[model samples]
Target: MTSIVTIARLGAQADGIADAPGGQIFVPFTLPGERVNVAVSGKKADIVALLDPSPLRVTPPCRHFGDCGGCSIQHLEQQAYRDWKRQNLIDALRARGIEIEVDALVECPPHSRRRAALTARKTEKGLLLGFNAALSHRIVDLEECPVMLPSIVEQLDMLRGLGLLVAQTKEPFRMAVTQSASGLDVATDDSGALEGPARQAAVEYCIANGIARLSVDGEIIVEPKKPVIMIDGVAVIPPPGAFLQAVENAEHVMAKLVVEHLRKAKRVADLFSGIGTFALRLARQSEVHAAEGDAPALAALDRGFRYGDGLKRVTIEKRDLFRRPLTYKELDLKFDGLVFDPPRAGAEDQARQIARSTVQRVAAVSCNPITLARDLSILIEGGYVLKRVVPVDQFLWSSHLETVALLEKPKKRR
Candidate 1:
């Protein structure tokens, strides 16, 4: 049935939500205040006609905006788009009973995403390669992706050719590509067995195309050059399919915030430090102890620290922080400051320890606002003062935000 409804707000997935008589309806590629005539089914609706269009809705830049799931809010005006993104952080914190001021959302421009996980499939006709469609398994064959680096987008044909070379199954597999300092680093998963002639072909194609490295299922196929990503002039080789900040500019912004915030500390504990993005930079001023679970990442960080000169004493420990977070007794009085950048599930256990410890300064970097708010509340309850929260737009046009928060504990009142 076709029904008209005015969008009340944007949901967490950036979908427009309308308060209907039954309940709420979600419409993709829509904006608030727009009266849309939608074909209703269950709780989902498809816009058949626009009775009224929102002023904030503008022309999306990319032709693949609606089809490609990589970006969501491209149709929104720039200022309004940013406000909505920033409000996510504010609202998340407020829900945790901590009303704090949040900085403006950091701008991430087009062609800035350094890493992407794309889908590839081989059929009887030919090879198919691109990002998966929104909430679907179907892959949208890419002529171009505005969010990725031009170098990566321009070489789509070459990637497709390479995909044809290594595709072992008819079902779609994954290829994670990252733009490194040397060249493009590509890694694929579920690429069955490539041996003898097939292996030789894959290796030759990568070398011929000047790919920095190519790996399948965590096994290196060809490494013409070690994939290097420079962090504050310190070049660190990232392990195969390792996690690094998605955008270079956003990483630098977060790192600068961390480094400046903990500059005065003589000793700093860098927790969940992957490839020493912040630890290596922080070592220029402070003695650093970086801990992480990934052995390869920690090894690469160790190599970077050992080779780099003019940095203070730097150390690395391979440990699962989630399983065994540093306790308050272990953290107390050992470091003046601490910096932690955990995965999407924010550091709850570690935050509890930091709350109880005597660490004077803390910088918490997070990609999820709800979990960040939960962890920050723990610290706030333990007497740590929430100073400033800056939201970085690493994942542009998406619901995700990278935030760097600075907190401090006052000295004894006596």
Candidate 2:
């Protein structure tokens, strides 16, 4: 049944929430204080009509805005959008009792995302290629995605050709296409096996299109050129399907904050350092000891350093930080400052270890706010003074925010 309700607030995922009869209703595409006529079913809602629209709502840039699921808040105005993203970070820090003022949201441009994580499936009609719809398995076949680099969007036809030739499963599979300095690096997962004549056709397609590399199920089919991503003028070739920051602009912004914070330190330890995104850049000034579990990533980091000139001495360690965090003893005298950018789980065990260490400056770079808050709280409990944090909106229109937080552990009594 359709019902009129006033949105109370935005949920963590940017869904509009309303107090309903039993508990609450979540409606997408609605902003707080907007009275919407929604079709209510259980705890879910679909906008039948907007009884009252929030002034914050504006005309979304793309025609696929509501359906693509690549962006959530495109309808929101620019300043209000920035404020909402920044407020989320502030609220997360406040929950941890670290009430320092967070810097304004570092707004990334619409077409700056270098990485596009999409879903694709082959249908009788043709091949479906795009991101999955929000909170559903259904794919929204994209005509255009404003958030991704035009370099990637322009090559979608080529990607679709590969999908048509190689896709063996009717079910949707992951299609990750990253625009690197070299060319478009493509990887697919769970798309069934590619063998026989289909494989040959796919290879031919990549060669003809000047695709840098193509990998399916982590196995490289062809690497025409080394997929190199420039890190502040330094070149680093990552392994196939490796994880890097999604936005180049955001990566640079975060790196600047980290490097400046640890500039005074002669030596720095970079933990969870994948492909030396920060460690390689940090080596421009400070000697860096980079630790990460991915062997290929570490090797890439080492190679990038050796090939590039004028960097300080750099070392690499291959260890799972999640399983075996660096102990306080190892961390104490090894480095003057430390920077860690872990996966979404947020390095709790590692954070606890860092809290016990005597490292003077700590830079915590995280993508998830909840886990970041928890980890920051642990450091605070160990007497680290929370300085300030800057929120980076690399994932434009999405709920995700990249944050850089600086902390300091006071010197012990002499």
Candidate 3:
């Protein structure tokens, strides 16, 4: 049995760090300054008993708090969790000797997640449906997830039952459920392995149960038949697996921040533009070139562009920026500013290319702070100055943090 110890600090993986006799031990579900009896589960340890709980440790809001992998810090006070994420970003940048004001943490409401990919498994007990347990392949059984929107949580039992039926077929499958402004979508595994009657059964079951759209193997078979979400009475239909920011209201907030930063620009290039979320919105005030690698996403953008007035001013291009970054010469037509919403692996070569570009202003949106810091270091070394860094709590309660930054070219020194 491992000796109980006092957790001194919080680690990167949302675990508590304790000083052991020989070295340091990382313990999960134990907060800083908390003395807990731990059971060494594997290479790491788990909290078995809390001898002295930290003042900051509060009862988790969710019933499935420890079991569901969607959130790690639900036990931490809501306000403290926000502060920790803000400090995390600040510390990450400071490690690179970069300095900037981290704006107030934008808090996401509890149970506001609109998109999730839950795993399902057939066990002796029944069908298990939920996120994979932290650092384990075991699927956590969840009656209802607190972090998901109520509409989604309401359908938990139905989803589990469906999963059980699918599992009984002895076929492997995964589900991607998304809640849009209009209705809901349920997508099943589309590896092209399941076909004939079984495939038909899944589709029929979803349609009969009121699933708006059904995708098999990444292809949208059932058109989104639900009523569109109206913004100012304008109906909008987001594409399947399109990069919609997960938080319910954070998308609008992030768009506002980006627009405020790029207000004066006449022309802007939006890289990794998914379904023109920011690009189309930005086009209302400036010309935009929406560059993305995925053909289906671009096609969806093209369709949206045809109908929306704001998108009419935006141009679409399908290019894999990772394989071949846009060079200064390639971007012969100079723009006043640039915006990029890159994936988790933050833009490396693209950031360098932006540094070399003639554009005077740049707005970057990043999901991972470590990669964001690394990319920022490259841009700073190449003579770009970070003006502001805003930490957005898009994925609240989760370890993930999203940030948007404003950068400008520094004056050349003699």
Whole-structure CA lDDT of model 3: 0.76
Give each model a TM-score.
0.98, 0.97, 0.92
lDDT string for model 3 (265-350, tens) is 88888889887778777877888888899877777666666677544377888999988777765553757778888999988989
Residue-level lDDT tens digits of model 2 in 255-320: 999999999989999999999999988999999999999998999899999899889999999999
lDDT of 3 at 10: 83
- lDDT (10s digit) by residue, model 1, range 1-414: 999999999987899999999999999989999999999999999889988999898999888888988888899999999999999899999999988879988898989899999998997767778888888999888888878999899999999989888987888999999999999999999978778898999999999999999999989999999888998888898889999899999998998999999999999999999999999999999999999999999999999998898999998889899999988887885899999999999899999999999899999999999999999999999999999999999898999889999999998787
Stretches of candidate 1 off by over 4 Å are none
- Whole-model lDDT for model 2 versus the true structure? 0.91
Which residue ranges in model 2 land beyond 4 Å of their true spot?
Answer: none
TM match of model 3 to true structure: 0.92
Q: Pick the winner on TM-score between candidates 1 and 3.
A: 1
Tell me the TM-score of model 1: 0.98
Ranking by TM-score: 1, 2, 3
Candidates 2 and 3, the one with greater TM-score: 2
lDDT of 2 at 7: 96
